[model samples]
Target: MSILPELERRFRRALAPVEEDPDPLLAMIRRSQDPKFGDYQANFAMALGKKLGRDPRQLAAEVAGRLSVDGFCQPPEVAGPGFINLRVRDDWIVDQLTAAIGDERLGVPAAAEPKTYVVDFSAPNVAKPMHVGHIRSTSIGDALARTLRFAGHRVVTDNHIGDWGTQFGMIIYGYRNFCDGEAYGQNPVGELSRLYQLVRRLIDYHAGKTRLAPLAEKLAGLESRLAEMHAEAAAEGKTGDKRVKKAIHRQQKDIDEAREELGELRAKLEAVEQDPELSKLAAEHPRIGQSVLGETSRLHAGDEENRRLWREFLPPCLAALGATYKRLGVAFDHTLGESFYHQRLRPIVEELIAAGIARESDGAVGIFFEGQDAPMLIRKKDGAFLYATTDLATLRYRVEAWQPDAILYVVDFRQSLHFENLFAAARRMGYERLELKHVSFGTVLGEDGRPFKTREGDAVGLESLLDEAVARARKIVEENDDAKPGGAELSPSQRARIAETVGIAALKYADLSQNRDSDYVFSYDKMLAMNGNTATYMQYAYARVRSIFAKGGVDAEALRASRPPIFLNTPAERDLALELLRFGEAVDYCLKDYRPNQLTSYLFELANCYSTFFENCPVLKAETPELRQSRLVLCDLTARTIQKGLGLLGIDVVEKM
Candidate 1:
């Protein structure tokens, strides 16, 4: 029933004698990129001639003469440079359209070998409100998941929540310090948020103080020492044993410089110690404050209370994230946060130690990869675990649990290095079996060409943005009410439903229609416009077709009773039919690239073709019954195409206006 498949089969059978590879014949079936050329031009003859050392033009003529493809297409004709130009017959178009109307898959086949994929995305930290930055992961992740699912793959979405680490220490600290019992009892999140703010204020208050200045001085001293050592090593490598004395002198100089800096810090601290008021403040502040800071340190070491708090809060926060997923129509199979790999960390550390991949440097266990300038720190000098450790453990967990063919991380470009290191480490550990991909995206810019934000230039909350979309949609729908007969008289609930459909569709389409990795200006006016590539445009297309069916009083089942003879000899009819026939191919293309803009572009062109056909050709007013029914079927198929395409992108269609 598939026109392309039938064409391919016929092409293969016809060329079986002259051709050994089938790819050449298959490539000839695709439409020519340039319209100036024939509908489809095959260059396989030239390639084959080059291989066989035969005359190209004669080879093309021979292949064209042997083709028995008249049933679905015109006789092949040889053209410039030994290319076979194919012009499809009008009947083939008609037959294909009829079959597609009745077919659910629309003649597209599933992948022969489907692979299981794990997609990690939309991982927001608990106790932190979701912002505009989160949209890239949430939206892009959902689209990718949908595309993979449509491509016939079993995809598992995993939201790796930022539910553990130093933030918890601050939260626990600020909770005990600032919690208003009655207020906290009423709302846990609000109290948690208040605690976060209090901690932020505390950190800001002490960060610039003289007491904590020594730690910065110490880090600078260490860096200077390391830089000097590097220079000495370079000198030694260049001069060999002849300049060993020079290298030693350079090394001594670097050590002396670092020691001098440390001595200055010690002298300053000693001076401050002699002054009682300064001494008290220094004790209160210190180079670091709060012993609980040690808990974050031990978290990297896989400590118990830290582990327990992470386990207790991670699931609750994940549940909260699922609520957002419900709103956005995103779902995940299994969630593996930092805590999920709590048990695996020790073994991973032991493996690194045993295999000599990691060594204890300055009290920290770290692994220096083959080409990396910096080592992957598994544990800090204070024996604490970090994001890198959890990520490693999570990567191992996914590989072992799923044995997936592909592990896709739908994260921001900012985390590119993190994933690179993770992948490198996994590869080094013999996980060369899985496909690791990072689907990174750019920022969503504001009118000022920066990341999208509110009027105050702070992060815009997702819920508030969605609500504004609904409000704008309501106004646009109201303005266009006169276009519909009873649109104005509709009840508030009905009006609300229409607004919701238009609003959501606009929001989703606006985001999806842009390049996946490009920063886009978020404009309500642009997104909500009823014309162009906006969702409202597609919805309007569907509505127009529905209006025709309603006015004609012909049900879809009745219209499809027969193929209703179609004639595409006219340019407009041919163009519309051609665009209509491309629906399946366009969907397949979108799935291939994980880009919904492909589908949007096709829908827009289809609508434009419909508009052209509307002007030149009459449907209900056609001179004959056969032409009228055939046009009606075209209209019905268009509506279905728009509905199905938009549905795949998670957009809705309205019946009126």
Candidate 2:
């Protein structure tokens, strides 16, 4: 229903008589970069002429003559170098606007062929508090699901939580050794989180202590090697030689990295040693790492006490996760945790072995690839099932139960090899027809260009992050509301409500606006700014449009009922209308590559176009009543488009931000 796709469809029909497969040629048609050229342009004639051995300009003229785009565009003009420029008709734009005004979905039509999709994302370990690392997966996955469904796809969002993992083992070990019963009774999840952290800290302390000697030796050897390289370079006067310089540079980098590693290990060890209580605990539990693993094995093996403890601990952990999801406005169609597939893990491994897809590798079961040095391990030598095993079981269950056309894993890029092997193994096990994709993303870095962390080097908690964003947003909201021309118009409760919406929208939009594969530095000031591509700007744009109707005492529904004729009297009006009508095209581009930033870019452009229109064209103050009604319709349409686009990105707009 968008202009480009409709143009492409017509081009496909016109090119059918000249070429057998016109898809490659049709792809050359795109929106013209400059308005002076036209609304859309096609540059396929040169390629087509090359293929058919004809003059490109002559071929373009012939193709343009044969094109049937009546009422949609002007007659195609064969420009220089066999380019075809087609400008849409003004009446066509008016007709589209009129139809969109009365339609709930605007002018965006349902997909002709929709497919079922299963989106797997946000698989945080429920035993620990959700942290900043989980934000990208949760936000990206939710936005993709919303956009795909709006684009007329059957989307199933599954939060495959990590319920049965080693983290739980650490929690169990900590509870047995260090739990405060009164604290647990008061706040089970909080106590469990504390215990998990305590056990993990002790394990890290011991591990660092054990690795301190080897790391120091490695650092010393690296420093010695670097000195030798420098001395050789200076003595031989080979410093100017590119190879010697490169070797020295590489050697220095290695030495620096080694020294940094050694320093971090020493710092961790010192922290534990300085804390009297922690030092005592570390001495008492020197083998915490192995002991935690033993507890995990017992739980997995159905030991009665560990099993009972797991059952008791799961509910509070789940409740905590649910509250966070609620705050973020994210929901999943199905939450199938790792424990759900435990019973089937063994059977899946046995089936893989029977099918010859897997074999014994050093007393462990794994799937080997032709060139891969390391096989995909499904079970350890000690008969403990691994994550890969559970993943295989989950894949089989989804295929059998949902019969989806595709399953997308929204995870970080570090697991690229794991997904590569998982997909390869799945194909070997007869899942060749299904679409398996790994939507990998990069890290969230702090201003220091490293992974975001607290002063203690711990991950920033998700709840605390939300709290800070809201607190900052509340301050902004109160200032703006109090500075209104007529005085403060919002009550405390209303101010609080608006602050929450803006704060959450700012957070979600900040992540959604970036290219999902690139690492982005987090900054509150930039994300919450009143201008640029921030959600605050878009929300303000929407509010500005709504204010036009409110001030005029106009009923938007009644105006739409009147169905006033849309007029593109000025360049600004026409540009705004064109951008408004291309909402469906933006959604299509977004789903084409599973990238939400595409939608964000489109919304930002639409906002800019509307701003231009507002500056140049008046709505309620138009010259005539009919013109006034038409402009009002444009304002309403702009507000609706902005709202719908932001909604698709899992953001809300304030009516008076």
Backbone clashes per model, in order?
A: 4, 0
On lDDT, the candidate that comes out on top is 2
Q: lDDT scores for all predictions?
A: 0.74, 0.91
**Candidate 1 residue 232 C-alpha distance from true site, Å:** 27
Clashing pairs in 1: 297-384, 300-384, 300-385, 301-385
Please write out the lDDT profile of model 1 over residues 1-657, one tens digit for every residue.
Answer: 444556677778767888788775576566667765656667777778888899889988997787787776778788888888777777888888878767765545666689999889888777566776787677767777776776678888888877665677666666655578787677666677667655653454344344446656665676676667667767668535546657656666766776665555555455556768556644564433354476556665667776675555555455666776677777778776665676777788878788876788878888787777888889877555767888888888888888899988877777788888888878888889888988777778887886786653358877677788889999878777745655465567877888987887788788888877787788878887767888888888788888888878888877777657666757888888878877767766776656667878888888888878878888889888878887888888888878877777777788876
**TM-score for each candidate, following the candidate numbering:** 0.79, 0.97
> In model 2, which runs have C-alpha deviations exceeding 4 angstroms?
228-245
> After aligning candidate 2 to the native by TM-score, how far in Å is the CA of 112 from where it should be?
1.0
Q: lDDT tens digits, residues 1-657, model 2?
A: 589888888988889889999988988998799887798899999999999999999999998998999999998999898999999998999999989988989999988899999999998999989998999999999998998899888999999999998998999999999999999999999999999999999999989988999988888898888889888989999979999999988988988898888888888889999999999999999899999999998988999999999999999999999999998899999999999998998888998899899999899999999998999999999888899999999999999989999999999999999999999999998899999999888899898899999988999999998988898899999999889887897889888988998998888889989999999788878877756988888898899888888889999889899898888999999999999988998998898788999999999999999999999888888999989988998999999999999999888888786
Q: Supply the global lDDT for candidate 1.
A: 0.74
Task: Candidate 2: count the clashes.
Answer: 0
Candidate 2 residue-wise lDDT at 303: 94
Q: Could you tell me the lDDT of residue 69 within candidate 1?
A: 78
